[model samples]
Target chain A: MSSLVALLHATRIELLRTLRDGSTLLMMGFPVLLYPAMIWGLTQAGLYIDEARDRETLVLGVADGVDTEGLGDDKVQIVPATLETLDAGDVDALLAGAGDGLELHYRAGSPRSRRTRRVVEDRIEARNTERVDAAAVEKGADAALLAPLEVDVDAIDDATPLVQFLIGLFACAFVPMSIIVSTYSPVVELFVAERERGSIETTLCAPIPRSRIVYARVLAAALLGSLAALGNLGALWITVLHGAVLVVEDPVSLPFPGPVVLGTILALVLSAALLVAVLMSVALSAARTHREGQTLANFVLLPLIVPSMAGMLAVISESSRDVLFVPIAHTGTLLYAAIRHELVATDLFVAVGLDLALAALVLGGWMATLGPTSLIEGIQRPAWLARLAGES
Target chain B: MIEVDALVKVYPGHPPVRAVDGVSFEARRGEVFGLLGANGAGKTTTLRMLVTLLSPDGGTARVNGHDVRTAPEAVRGSVGYLSVTTGLYERLTPREMLVSFGRMQQIADPVGRAEQLIARFGIGAFADQRCGRLSTGMKQKVSIARALVHDPPVLILDEPTVGLDVLVAQTFLEFVETAREEGRAVLYSTHIMSEVERLCDRVAIIHEGRIVAATSVAALVAEHGTVEKGFVATVNGA
Candidate 1:
């Protein structure tokens, strides 16, 4: 009971320090402000380019003996010309040939030339349909029978491909990356900065065991990581998806993930934060200063990002439970599935269980090295680490 | 009270160095004991062993009747350790710092004890101010108060006045004297001859990793004409 109380007191102190740190606040605020500003800027740029494309008029050249009764529009200027004028850049596009072999020619590099080609092709297609209908009626055949078949392919009930990709990327990559960024600064401040300022020696002299100190510090960092992940997730859902709906006018259905999916997402985020906190706490314990700690953490955490990137590209089937064995990749895959509302209960269990297990294993081993000797004289390189450097 | 018997600490390297070798001393309640040494003389190492911060490789140390190796937590709880390198939390206020350390020590009433120390140490004026914003003298006072918050019976101070101005250093010496008068065993470590002459009841002059002279300050001064001369002769003779 006394140890519990001591742990609580220690945690409170760590939390107070973490909350007052300016770098932590900035890292937490990154997603909230960056997403909105980025989306707004992108939206404005897209709208401006589209409006400019719509306002500009393009010159279209009609070759001799081609149908030209109805082709001009407010944005297209019809002109009589030969292949010479088309090649000389006098016209944006050339509508040449006739009958079943109509040819539309344009400069591929010019934006206005491409636009003009599309407009001329559309007009000619409409005219051809009319003429075909008229000819069919005169030949005593049904005009309706001449209509071309149309097919519409829908991947989901209503969600577009762009929306699905955005949601998948945000879940599999952004949230996890935010959690990592959030967990980093606090670990450095708590472990390396304290050592640099000489406060760690004083804290080590307390009656409490070093394991309790490690636990308190890890808990504080994990809490910050989880909160930052949630903030970034919420900000992403609001700024990007909702903004897409309002601007794109595509009947975009905002994904209201079911309760199960929501719960799984929360679990994945918390477990991931816990894992990162434990990993960083142990890795940074060897560092003597903040700068060194940060550099070391960057190298240690680089491998975790690969799983998230792979999850973005991988299409895991519902029956493929083998993917759950991979540590962080499992979380990323589950996150992608959960965002798409296809997550299975068994997979969620496997992912979170694996994460917690890894965290426990690291914590157990880290506790053994927390003696005063290690704290004061610095931790010696383990045999495996030495062998990894070819020192053995 | 503190008792150290044949304390030994060795650093394993290309060549092993026995930083503290067969050093022995006893500091009873109501007296101040000084460990006088130069750089690399193992003064800090011995103090760290007493406070349970480092384990003696081949010796036994007892603080307030608790053996360091057998009951390190108890020994740690019974001693208040302060050093020049000991630092306070910069983001925490003096009052918060006191309460935090008090709770870590498992004091019965941390808040109340923190208040008492603040008032006793004259830290009430800046109890609410952050440690980073305070002057160096104020920070040292807060550090002293933090060390004593647990009311430990033994106080281990290792070069606690290395960087302080004369006035602040004098104030620290006065606190050491107060701790002695209050029936606490004070283990002061430094190389300053004046501090040893004025504050120490018994002095141990250490050379390399062993004690060369252990006697009362008055006796050493009488024999060598001054504490400085006594320290030099004792160190050279060793």
Candidate 2:
């Protein structure tokens, strides 16, 4: 009971410290706000370009002998002009006279014009195919035999492109989140700074068990991590909702479904747990200096980020199931898959189980190494050099 | 009371290093025992063993008759330790930290105890201030309050007054004296000769992971002319 109290006290202190640290707050909250804006802005810009390109009018100047009727519709306008009128740049003036906008020039039998003429040529091919089918029908051959096999392409579900995009966006956010966990200074500083300031020694000397001290530290880190995760979730949800409002007219409304919401919350908890375990292990194993410990703790984040990146790219490619099982990859996959309405129960269980297992292994390692002797003596230089050869 | 018998700690390497080489000592109730050594002299290692932070490679250590190796909780429950580096949560106010630590120690009326300690330390002015924003002296007071939160019977302070101003160090020594008067067994470790002379009832001079000499500070000072010279002669084998 006393030990439990000590652990809680220790954890509370740690959490308070992290919350008050301005740099930590900035490091965690900045990216959460910034990343969504960047993603939404870039996506909006891309959509604008696509819209513009869709409305762009292509002007074509046909050779003198080509039929103007084949051009079809107002999608591409065609005008006939004499070589003398075109060569003198008079076609530009002529189009202005006609108020038809810009004019593209073509010469008789020119290969450059021939390549440009391919766009109109596709209609000719369709007409030729119709003629060929007619001829085959007259010969009593099956018209179906003349046609190639048809492929029916269906989307996995009714998930809108916007939902798919959000999934991808969420996956990208995980990279920053993972980086936030690994690089956050307070996590490392909690132990390393205390050791440097001589406070760790004071606590060690106190009538408190080492395990209690460790538990307190871990609990504190976990609490801070959860807070950070919550902040991120709120920022992300708001950004996503705003982006959806802008791009998805009459967006398909789903009350953040219970399972998906539950899964996300669980993922956040497990992520925080894993992060705390890693942070504790690094903090415990590091030397007394805060800088050294910070560097070491930051190193562990590299692997976590790789999985997130791979997951992001894999989502774009709709890659295989193997990608979904890799640490941070699983979080992104589950989140996106849930958004897309394609997540399976078995897959969710697998992802949660894997993350829990990883957290356990890391926490177990930290717990095993929480003895006072290991923590204090583990970082110290050897002692024999202090002795004069014959002094002992 | 604390008893450390043949406590040894070895780190494996190309050639193993013995951090604490068969160190043994005893501190009776209400006594202030000083462990003296230069840098890397095994003073910290020995103190750590007594605190149940490090496991001894050989022999055993007990606090209040509870074995540190087997019954660490009992030892932890009875001992208050302060290392050279003050481990404090810099974000918490001294009062909050003390109260929290008291609660952790399962002390009754922790908040009330925290207020009392704050008033006793004359740190009430800064009681509500974050520890990180406090000066070094204030931080040390917070650490001391945290150590005493549970009001344990044994106090193990490893270079507690290190890096403090003379005035702060003097006040800390007075605090140690008061702890002793309250019947707590205090183990103080340092390389500072004057502190051992002024504060300790008995002194153990350690060298190269072993205690080279052990005696009352007054007797050693009288015999060797000064505590500094006595420490040097004992540690240097002169």
Candidate 3:
């Protein structure tokens, strides 16, 4: 009961401390407002890709006396020019007409050149198939009799292009980014910064136990991080809407179902709590100064970012019990699935169980490491020098 | 009263260091006991052990009848500690810092207690200002107010006047006298001979992690002409 009171006071102080640091506030709040605009601009990128794929064919320079009737798309204009002049840069491709075949040439590495080559080749192939069909018709044979097999395909995928993109980008990329921006300074400020500035000694001298102090700081960080995450998602929502109007005409919105959204938020809370405990313990363990704490917190980003990036990119999109066992990646995958409306009972259950277990373990480790003596000797050197110093 | 017996602390390293080696002292009710030493002479370490910041490897300390090792919470609840290294949270206002400390000490009506200390310390002028923006003297005043808000019966101050201007330092010295008069046992550590002469009823001179002398200032002056010379003589005699 007494520990609870001490924790409340400590958490209140920690939260107020973070609110006052101008840099921390800016780092957390700006992304929410700016990212939406950036997301809305992605529509232009899609338009570019679509335009690139279906462009009108440029003039295909042909040798004189080459019969070019019905050879390619009607929009493609045939021109009379020597292969060298055309190939040099005047046309999309140069064609040397043979008796019944053609040789096509284009620039070696350009994407436009590759597109021209594919178009010309496809035109010739289509012509060849047409000739075969005409010959068969003249022989009084049905064209459908040419092949024995008949195949039909019925395809269904509920995810829209934008929805897929969001799900793919969410897990590894967005979650960890939110964690980093939201919790980094506060974690350092609460634990390592206190120790560095020598205020930790004063806090330790209080009648409250060190465990309560650790609890208060961790909870405070988690609460702030959760707020940042919700803000990020909210910004992402508005941005996606902006992108819909600008990038896709009448793009369908894929909102997570009400329960699913709440569950994802709860998952974010758990993952953030786990991250805070781990980072604070690592920071307080390895750092003696705020600068050193910042460096250590950056190192923590390595593990958080890599797996989450993989998940968000759909490099590992398949959900399973095994995936749920992983820490940050699990949170990312579960959140992605929930957003895509593909989340299932087992995925959420496993995610909750796994994250809670990890949080407990990390928090327990932090509690074990916290003490007056450890703070007095928290770390002898910067984390970077520990290896070098150890060898010496 | 604060009682300490043969307290020891050995810091583990390439070659272990005995930071405080079997030190002992006592500060009785209504007395200001001074522990004087050079830097790294175990004065802070001994005080830290008493305040329950660092645990002793051997022996024990008791503040207000609470055993430091077994009943450290009670010891902390009973004693207020101040030191040069003890700092205020820079982002919090002086009032917030004091109220937070009061709450930690589980004071009823913590805000009211903080208000009283704020007025007593003349902190009302800038009590709402964040500590980081405060002048050094103002910060010192806040730190003092924070320590006193809990109204603990014992005070352990380690160089609490290290950076204060002479005038503010004098104000703090007067407060110490007031605390002593209220029958609060004060264990004060410093190397400043003048403050020690004015405040301490008894003096313990520590050298190289061990106590070399423990006596009243008058007896030391009778033997060595002054507490400053007595400190030099005691440290050198060891």
For all candidates listed, what's the TM-score of chain B alone? Answer: 0.98, 0.96, 0.98
> Per-residue lDDT tens digits of candidate 1, residues A1-392?
47777777788899898888888789777877888888788767765664564444433422122333344432232444332233353432222222233222221112322233343345433553354345434544444444432211212345555665566666666777777888887877887788789987788788877678878888788888888887887778767675664334345667566787778888998898889888887777666776667667876678777765555445433322456777666666777777767778888988899889999888776566465345333467666643442342
What would the per-residue lDDT of candidate 2 be over residues A1-392, giving only the tens digit for each residue?
Answer: 55565566677767777778777777667757785887689667756654443333333342122233344435233544332233344434433433222222222222122222332233223443354345444544455544411112222233355654674467444633544473455566566667566556555655566656665665566666656665565566556655554444344454464776656655644564555455555444544565555555555666556776777777767772777577667666666666566777777777777776776676566457554334433354334321211112
Candidate 3 residue lDDT tens string, A1-392: 45666677788887999878887787778778777657645655655653564443333422212233345544233454332343353433222222122222221112233233343345433343354344434444455543211111112234265655554455346755676657776777777778778887778877777667767777787777777777777677566655544423344566555875776656755565556555655555666676766666666766676766655544354543355666666666666666666677776777677766777776676556664345333655544565432322
Candidate topping DockQ: 1
Task: Tell me the deviation in Å of residue B185 in model 3.
Answer: 0.9
CA lDDT, every model vs. true structure: 0.75, 0.66, 0.70
Q: Please write out the lDDT profile of model 3 over residues B1-238, one tens digit for every residue.
A: 8888998998887698998988988899999999999999999889988888778999888889999999988998998889998899999999988888888888888899999999998999999999999998898889888888888899999999998899889989999999999999999999999999999999998888998899998899889999999999899889
Chain A TM-score of each model, in the order shown?
Answer: 0.70, 0.61, 0.64
Write one digit per residue (lDDT tens) for candidate 2, span B1-238: 8898888999788799998898889998999999999999899888888887777899899999899989877887788888766567677788888887776667789999998888888889999998878988888888788888888899999998888999988889999999999999999998888888888999888889988888998899899998999998887782
TM-scores for every predicted model: 0.82, 0.74, 0.79
Backbone clashes under 3 angstroms, per model: 0, 13, 5
DockQ of each: 0.70, 0.44, 0.62
Q: When superposed on Cα atoms, how far off is each prediction in RMSD? A: 6.7, 9.9, 8.1
Q: Which stretches of candidate 3 lie over 4 Å from their true place?
A: A1-6, A40-161, A164-168, A251-260, A315-322, A369-392
Lowest summed lDDT across 10 adjacent residues in model 3 chain A is found at A147-156
